[model samples]
Target: MPQPNDHRLFAVILGTNEIASAIALQLVRAGYCVVLSHDPDPPVIRRKMAFHDALFTDTAQLEDIVAERVDDGVQVYQALRRPPQVMVTWLGLLDLLPVRHIDLLIDARLQKRRVTPDLRRLARLTIGLGPGFSSDFNCDVAVETRPGKIGFVTDARWTDAADGVASSLGDVGAERFVYSQFAGRWHTPIEIGTRVYRDLVLGHLSGVPLLAPRDGILRGIVRDGSEVPAGVKLLEVDPRGRDAQWTGTDQRGRAIANAATAAVRLHAARRSTHRNPA
Candidate 1:
């Protein structure tokens, strides 16, 4: 059980992808207690940017902050004692933890669907990201995640246009992405963040060579020993090489992070005013 602090707000972030990691980083910097919710066996391609990778490694660090995987609510309480800390847990145990203690719930799963009924009412403020969500019905706020309209926050009913295509980085969109051709366990020989040329053999999927589509830096890749299905994204290359690796939090992710932080502060202020009407 976490110690009660009327002045402190507790934020629970669902998912630990790039956008979610950015939001968690911002919220922690803003002095909110953050709990990063994730799956036990997360299939995160961008391992460097996702804190959910902590599930396998026991701990994953982003910039200066570190996320530690916890087994139960007691550990979560202990972790929260340190401000700007992150407690990682799966959904099942997450629901078992005390919900009343959560001040905000951010559904950053980017699952392209609405959250379940129980999640909508879990915290004082609930926020959903991307498509498949109606702000008026699914959550208190919805953050736009499409290419051009990224970072747009709304409280009214709104749905983003479904393009069903990944955002392109010049001609690098689909080409940069590497997928498994056969359904089986994937084995990668090249490490993430490594520089490679076009047609470079990265690894083997069901004994077939997984090659790079273009000359670029290996920015993101699935775990080496993950059981991958056919057509699953295996990795991605950044054609811009080392320059792209230095560029932190792509435009869309940074934009969404900014909006989410603003919304959190706005809601916090409203709650403060309601409690001690001046």
Candidate 2:
């Protein structure tokens, strides 16, 4: 039988978005084994930095950490045995892993709705990021993800309500986004770091042009040949036109990572105190 403290903390992050990937990298840096769960067909717009892109490429590297797609629980365990390695898998394969091995479960999906996973009972500590999760009924802790309230980790009974609007960038606001007009395979004609003016054609989806909404650097965009649905975000332009946006983790992602680290430590200390009764 495995004891509670028999091994390093094994954290399963349920999503491969930027924040989730940031958290996984942070946990690995803290000497914890991390696994990322993602969908087989992830509709992620920021393919350059998202760990979910490993689903299509089979492997992805964030900073210095590398994540490889694994097929089953055995592979996940094997990947964890190698320190600094992270495993990526779809939800079904994630469910097949032994729940006893999970020390923490962080729901970083940011779906703005109730997650279907039985996360509270799946691990010793569970965390939900953004909205749509109640600490009293869903998880042990909920971290605020809204722009102004970013990184506010709490265990209160209530959860924050999603505003359903993207955080504005200075005076640029929502004009930095470009969406597809038709559901079909997407192809990009311009490179990611290219600076472009408003109305410049960035790509096309089933013959419909994906135009730039404003003048800025193309900070992020979906990969070419991706099957996209109509109205999906296809690209993002950084109005600041800074090259730093093309590389490394963003400020918001790092803040969320810090909050998750604090939550895990707090819960681990509490559990230890309960077990030893010092």
Candidate 3:
């Protein structure tokens, strides 16, 4: 176990979606102290594949990495000592992390098609993934998340837009995703990995019943009692049944994560060269 405060590179990821969780896992494995900033109730699919549930369950594991949610600054410090296991905080990681010590900042929230604010000066290196991110404007670096180009890191001024559809799985397309029909508290008894059939009452939004679109495993869903806004993704069905993958770091996620780690490595190497030219 690598010591927390002992020269290991530290990274802060904004968001706890599966993408963020994947990046955190690879970074930890590659010898970086990683911390995630986000709340517990994410409208995230693939619950077992991410740390968004850590805030709810207090701990979530992705592959060999475990993410524990820390309540305050003191707990964050203590959690760090448990090497390779990430610690998430509801409070801002930037606020809790030492002033100006963050080596890398990654925005993995993947706010598709939304024009987010510029991420300059947040860390020594800032990387934004997926659409609406471009190097030199929104972040120091931009990584491609479009299909066929998941890990193409670049310094380009613009990136392609998301097609407004998630990649298909087990021959299932966007129809497998369930979204909130209105802004309200979401309620559901079905847990992750539960088997369900079409028309099953998976949950409700402010009393509006939500039903399954097809027969399959409940791959991911919002926590049973989360307050969710209209149009946000609420749940997903894998449709693969016996072949369903309800856990572990996924393939595309790993590609995106590898890109993040690669960008950091290149940035650190460039900085080192500039400081000590040979």
Write the number of the candidate with greater TM-score, choosing between 2 and 3: 3
Q: List per-candidate RMSD values in Å.
A: 3.0, 3.1, 2.3
* Model 2 C-alpha lDDT per residue in residues 14-70, reported as the tens digit of each score: 787778888988898888778888742335655556687787788998899888887
Best TM-score goes to which candidate?
3
Top lDDT hit = 3
Model 2 segments more than 4 A misplaced: 1-8, 40-42, 91-96, 113-118, 181-183
User: Which digits, one per residue and each the tens of the lDDT, describe model 1 over residues 1-278?
Assistant: 44455546678887867778889888888887787777423246777876767877899888888888877776766555555577677655257347436778887877653343435677778888887666767788888898777888865866585566778775567888887776788788777788889888998887788788898888888777778766657888888744576224666777899998888888878989999998
Against the hidden reference, what TM-scores do the models get?
0.86, 0.87, 0.91
TM-score of 2: 0.87
How many residue-pair clashes does candidate 3 contain?
0
User: Better model by TM-score, 1 or 2?
Assistant: 2
Q: Tell me model 2's lDDT, rounded to 2 decimals.
A: 0.76
Q: In what order do the candidates fall by TM-score, top score first?
A: 3, 2, 1
Give residue 235's error in model 3 in angstroms.
Answer: 0.6
Q: Return the number of clashes found in candidate 1.
A: 0
lDDT per residue as tens, model 3, 6-112: 45576789888889999998888877777888833346767788888888788888877777887777665554565556877677855765633677889887777
